[model samples]
Target: MTKSPRFMQIKTYLLDKIESKTWPVGRRIPTEAELCEQFSVSRMTVNKAVRDLVNEGLLERTPRLGTFVCQRKAESPLMDIRNIADEIKERGQLHHSEVLSLKAIKAPEDVAMRLGIMLGGDVYKSEIIHFADNTPLQLEVRWVNPNYAPDYLAQDFTDKTPNQYLVDNCPLSAIEHTVEAIMPNEMIAQRLDIPLEQPCLLLHRRTWSGDQLISAALLYHPANRYKLSARTSL
Candidate 1:
């Protein structure tokens, strides 16, 4: 049998430690040099092992400090399209939003593809930061098909969320959602008030109203602050 690569072995060792609570949550793991010596491997191999863990949200790095096991994330159902404000209120927390941008713009390549519109086609865009009890909970960057909701740019998102407005105006018939754990970009990190190195749970969603594509949205949530879950009846 072919032996597993050294880096894979190292990664498995680290995963076992974290899963078993041998390196309990919030406890810092050994430095690269220490891991290299312990495993009798190059620093490059040890770094690869640790880096993968960080990317997976199993570990995190702090400047001027070592890497530590991350805390358990708060969960949100992955299949739900419920209003953020209603969800927060159900949790007994205040919900508010900051509408950073709301305007009609020429669609970029990705936005055009997602909305099934021609490149450079006119589309309504909005960037909003949603808060729960004063802490940033989500950063919503959305592109809307103006044909579906002509007044998308005019609504006051602070008083009513884009989701609520769209549900009322368009009446969704179908929806698609894709979820992943990813490192936040600078703007997303800044908007969500998280560090650039921190992992984030990204949800890409598309909605359709009676066979007409309505909106495409990228929702970013800080990984340490949030997680995605799912359940279904058999």
Candidate 2:
């Protein structure tokens, strides 16, 4: 076969480094001039290649900070999805997270329908426990649409909550929230560091960008440890 276009060659070169983690998440990539010099191609071609990767979520650009290898700001609990960190900061308490699990799994029927993907489609799932002053505050269980955030599985959420990451990386257009009281299961109770008999508050939230379902989450908080509040403006 004939050799591909210079831009294609350039794109593939950068993609290889990213996938192999040579350019890890949040690692700043070379500038257009740098790539132009390396590939001996015009700046326009390099820019086109970089722009394509950015649109694919493989690269991200900041106004003054330069482009970096995108981390796929996926689940791993956009760490402050519950705004737990901010709440703790406001109270002058230290905060952190216990990431229970992060992986890629085939979506079940109900989850697929809610995420607007076909059954068995790829989805990113994560479980996390948010802490306030070293006390468990909430257990966040989330499923993310892979299409919206293609590198979802490669993200490192140890330092941030899924909600915080997504909010920063992906622009959201809509949200639906529901809250109810329930007795958490054995696993959830243990993660929340509470007894199964204790009632828990479940916040089921579905987020979307326009008509596309971006993610669905179940935030479970111990009734005694946490309270739910809402604000409204008329």
Candidate 3:
């Protein structure tokens, strides 16, 4: 318990830098010596935090160079974001989805807190695997506010993506996305056909149509096959 908070503090500091885009990918971070001074911590403490991030694919260490933020596996625009289905179609790839589960359930605490609903309130949950040209590309797990999409569980996801349906039905005002690298569990690893050693790009998204939170989603992609890119005008 004593070591937990200190290491977490160090980890949170670095993660905040990456998540806020303050320390963009490819930017070399401060050396361990520098971090020790900045955080007033010991070398071993710094090493533990840094090593954990390296394993998560957030930081890369070179033989002589200091640690740097590694590239994200999938990129979306900072302002405007496109639905995954449309992105695949634009690339001329055959896009298909396999809906694994669709049903109404009580909102989990984490989800309810984000959606501004009761902890046990009804929410529609959807688990889907998206394929690009027959290759497993994404595992999409989404939680929907039934108040926004009452018929979410009744619709067939294979015909239209959960994201697309929400876009069509809701009046969107804001979208928030947080990207992180995560090592998958056995189930996710097997489903993605990727080894546990490989880090997966995990994107957490929350959508709001005006004042109502519409949906929250966790999107996962194998790191080797996916990278987030954006091209936009100033």
Query: Model 3, which residues run further than 4 Å from truth?
Result: 1-75, 230-234
Q: For candidate 2, write residues 1-234 as lDDT tens digits.
A: 999999999999999999899999889999889999999999999999999998777788989889988643212132123456776667666889988899999999988877878999989999988887777878888999888877766777768778777777677777888889999899989898899999988888888776778999888988765555565558
Q: Candidate 3, residue 16: CA error in Å?
A: 41
The models' CA-based lDDT, in order, is: 0.90, 0.81, 0.85
lDDT (10s digit) by residue, model 3, range 156-230:
899999887888999779988888999999988987888999899988889999888889989899986676655
User: What is candidate 1's TM-score against the reference?
Assistant: 0.69
Candidate with the larger lDDT of 1 and 3: 1
Give per-residue lDDT, candidate 1, residue 63. 88
How close to the true structure is residue 167 of candidate 3, measured as C-alpha lDDT? 88
Candidate 1 lDDT over 96-127, as tens digits, reads 99999999999989889999999999999999
Question: How far is each candidate from the true structure, as Cα RMSD in Å?
Answer: 8.9, 19.1, 13.2
Candidate 3 CA-lDDT value: 0.85
User: Which residue pairs in model 1 clash with each other?
Assistant: none
**In terms of TM-score, which candidate is stronger, 2 or 3?**
3
TM-score of each: 0.69, 0.63, 0.66
